[model samples]
Target chain A: MTTVGEALSALCTPALVVDVDKVKRNAQMMIERCQKLGVQLRPHMKTHKTLECADIMTGGSRRCIVVSTLAEACFYADHGFDDILYAYSLPFDKVERCAALSERLDLFQVLLDHPQALEQLKKRPLRDGRRWHTEGVELTGIYAHCGNTYNCRGVEQIQAVAQETTSFTLQFMEKLKAAGITCKSSIGSTPSCSHPVKDMAQLSEVHPGNYTFYDVQQSVIGSCSLEDVAVRVLTRVIGHCPHRNQLLIDCGWTGLSLDGAGKLPTGYAMIEGHPNLKLLSMTQEHGRVEPISGPLDYSKYPLGSLLTLIPYHSCATAMMHPVYHVHSGGRLLGKWTPTRGW
Target chain B: MTTVGEALSALCTPALVVDVDKVKRNAQMMIERCQKLGVQLRPHMKTHKTLECADIMTGGSRRCIVVSTLAEACFYADHGFDDILYAYSLPFDKVERCAALSERLDLFQVLLDHPQALEQLKKRPLRDGRRWHTEGVELTGIYAHCGNTYNCRGVEQIQAVAQETTSFTLQFMEKLKAAGITCKSSIGSTPSCSHPVKDMAQLSEVHPGNYTFYDVQQSVIGSCSLEDVAVRVLTRVIGHCPHRNQLLIDCGWTGLSLDGAGKLPTGYAMIEGHPNLKLLSMTQEHGRVEPISGPLDYSKYPLGSLLTLIPYHSCATAMMHPVYHVHSGGRLLGKWTPTRGW
Candidate 1:
């Protein structure tokens, strides 16, 4: 059992502490879910941007992986991985550079929702040694990508897009096949992953990263339950103003994020297991918690007691602190420090 | 002059390119403005998170600096800097850590809004005799915090609490005064920063972060103007689907975040300089732009042309890309990469 003193001094403050057992379980569970559905796992690396996290994928062939940025691509590629997909849309200016990057690797796949996007991307592949300038080539189409409808639109839109993305991928694949080109096609988005795979049979892979650490967005979208979220920031009750009915906290824009990207505008986060108490707001170094769930139980949760919270958005919250203090078997074990700097 | 090709190629595509000149101008301009109003400059490091950026402040002193993270505090402290104010609202659990960290440096100030937060922080200021916490026993109460109306019931509610914070700080200062204590008290936030100063004017300092990079939220609250926005993302059109009148581009979730924090339902971003073009939605890799203004002159502004746009939340957008490509004198200079990830 962790005493109050031990909990306070066990790790650095304002640092990300993760439950290793939970993280492992989350990874295993996602892999098993995909396996049962017969969907290939090409998880996105943007969630856990660390080599150590990449090495802990319960079980999967190293045939394919998805990335949001080219920096992530270069990171995984340098580790001797071959098949990679740059799932982000690219500007025409970077088309030639992407083609050059594709040539250096064994397999590289690009995703584009618009015909013109595909045209520019297809105009130059890695087949030839010389890098062709798409700038000199005549341009025709417009690229409007809207596969993820999580923010403005809700879960229903996400599901439709998943279905639409699969059919759209098929159409694009048909054109590529007609041109005698062979490439790996993929389907993704944390929200869309929960939908039934309509064309999973046609797709070569499925790359969804946040499924391992589902948030309020994923939970509301019917991806997973609140308990399934693996990542959380363990914080404390620092200042209690009975007058304002608000308690002060150490978690702020830096410890968590100033982002209110949840079903509700929860300014900060919720202390797990204590649903009523919402972290109402924050400044640079402080957090305000309102007793929304029930009465303020200062007995179980005194000023010095520790409370853990699952952030609303994993990507945004994860960017708040540096190292992840992981726990397994209810004891502090290892640590996972993510790569920093843009 | 940088041709479009040269500008895109010379700079790293996914880097946070900051034209040093623009940054210098931006920083210098803000400092001059604050000085004219007699407001002490405690520039928020959440924007740049770079030591070099901090080193170039208009004020030559080191004591008056504001930060968003503890890592930043440690960085500046290690660099022989002192009198740092963690503008983030921290909880009681982290207060001890901040106190402990204060030992290595000269003085570390923190923001407080709630009584419970301060209560929690006060209880755990020092843990062991063998190890001393950074926050000296001096209780150097440079209490720079804000209790604004948006979060508060009204000015009257926080006005009392603001007085409480000032008094709490004064009480702490009074104890020091008895033992010969000398400390600086400060207050900051956009809302109250504009209102007439009351008892808070006694604070030795005042600072605000987003006042520099104002967005629609600031404009709504009447903090800054739409023209005061210093940064925007430059994207291009890649496809044109005749059936839907839908336009697609490479700037999607990876380009723009899925966050519509303080924006209309148009999407995460709008077409800058082309208000008529509404950003209907966004996917992981595409942004669906439609013409709210008449049809584009396809001949002059075809699918391959570049368009500049602003972000709903500059903080998130700054974290998404690695480089901030600075354009100056019609020339694209070097890049400024912000510190990202916790």
Candidate 2:
């Protein structure tokens, strides 16, 4: 119900606010990066599943994209998006739904890491003469996630992991060629894709999702700088717990998730522009905030005062919200409702 | 969109299933207990925000309920439920919404723990002849939540905390009476209310929420037994990581929350009927589960085999799902959609 052109302060507390400008810049940068590498940028929609954000991530083509869940695949497919890649190992129970999407769309690709899953797809064949990846039970592409790159600390470490993943994938491709089986290859992860190695250019595609709205975790891993983070949980000071030396904010574990516990000097999330403060703990609907050092100057954070929290993991934090308040330059533009469930 | 009367195996994996029979039993038990204690039970709806669950918890009276957020208060009020008590320290930003509810409903109560919050209410006068409580800026009730009872390990410890909280609340009530400012007094928490002291009857009312869907955390804290828990996350084994001696489940942090980390011997959640398996870690859509003390027995758990997970914290886990599949005797009944956001 927040009106367009209204300031962020007009919205309620514990609200997820997205910087549209940052989103566009991040998406544009990733698109340009993938274009330069000559690899398709199949941006993952798990971070922000809204159609508006998906449109931005795909640069309005909505042709090639990656989704972590079948729910996202259906959501996008229903909205004219095609050539979708459901990047998770296919769940057996959802094969029927996936088959329907495959028949309806121009192309719907599913991943399988096991022979049993391949059998599930074979049982549910696509109608109208459509085949599963050009032929029945034919291999489409080798998708490898450089998830280990999340442990890297800097650009050098990120590139090293990316290089290692690309080399292994290329070597596997060579083995497939030796066996007279040729197929495409892809490797992805936000960190690896953000600092992609030269060898990654030899791959078929790159699927990185979190780069669209990079968070503190991404910044720490050198995927993007702190300024590149596009989302913030807007909360307000609701109570001043002087006895406990903690200020209770309206944001809690329900608003901001418990994803980054004990991982930051600022517990849970970083208090934007307030390094001395730490989010001590959270209940269902209340967060305890206190200073890292000296006594808190309560006058500075009076009742109803605004505080911005830069979440540690944007994907986890985004999942907690039903709608994202899209804003540009601190003014609300509209609300983006993300589709939920599997 | 799962059909009724279908077996649970027919539904998708990672879906939250609610045992309606257990839910009714739990609600009936709490009602009988409160009736025997000669105290009014104002059930908290923060744990399960669905109208159906609220109807069950309130015994269909649709009155005398406590909500953790204004959104729930509005949702219940819009559905013809009244006599709602927003059981949190009043946030200054929500005063207008509180005022609207106060004017709309026959009785809508707001709580404030600070003088500044009181001033916020004073600034916004309710419409018509309605007064804030008895008069303008009047104290309605003194509410206290004994959240510390969560650390208790047995019924004796729970009773001790209940007795202590009741004694403290009664003492505070006496002080208010001495100052000629008598009003209602209430104290609550699942652990404290589950094992109430005789002194709790002296209070005006009691509010307990989580007993409706008792979780592993509540059972561990002596609030309820493991058998009394009514909710389970139905996931499936999608991958077998033989190299790591692990099985990847479709349920992840997105399906089951990370609330009970390091609190249980079984890691995040307890695998029902399988004490040896541990949910070690989770990504966005993949949970790495392995045996607690030995290699995973993948033979017993093939691809797509259903695994029931007893959540450590039902409230945290329930918040992650958009819909709750209500069932009885392993047969699906219907789906319960919950209202989200502040």
- Per lDDT, the best of the predicted structures is 2
Q: After superposition, how far is residue B107 of candidate 1 from its true place, in Å?
A: 3.6
Regions more than 4 Å wrong, model 2: A134-137, B134-137
Q: For each candidate, what is chain B's TM-score?
A: 0.70, 0.98
Fnat, 2 decimals, each candidate: 0.27, 0.91
TM-score of chain A for candidate 2?
0.98
How well is each residue in A1-342 modelled by candidate 2, as lDDT tens digits?
578999999999899999999999999999999889888888889999989999999889988899988889999999999999999888989988989999999989889888888878788878999878734546889999999998999999999999999999999999988988889898889999998887888999999999988999999999999999999999999888889888989999999999999999999999998999999999999999999999999999988999999999999999999999999999999999999998
Q: What is the lDDT of candidate 1?
A: 0.61
Worst 10 residues of 1 chain B by lDDT: B127-136
lDDT of 2 by residue, B29-91 (tens): 999989999889999999989999999988999999999999899999999999999998888
Whole-model lDDT, model 2: 0.92
Cα-based lDDT at residue A243, candidate 1: 79
Q: Please report the TM-score between candidate 2 and the true structure.
A: 0.99
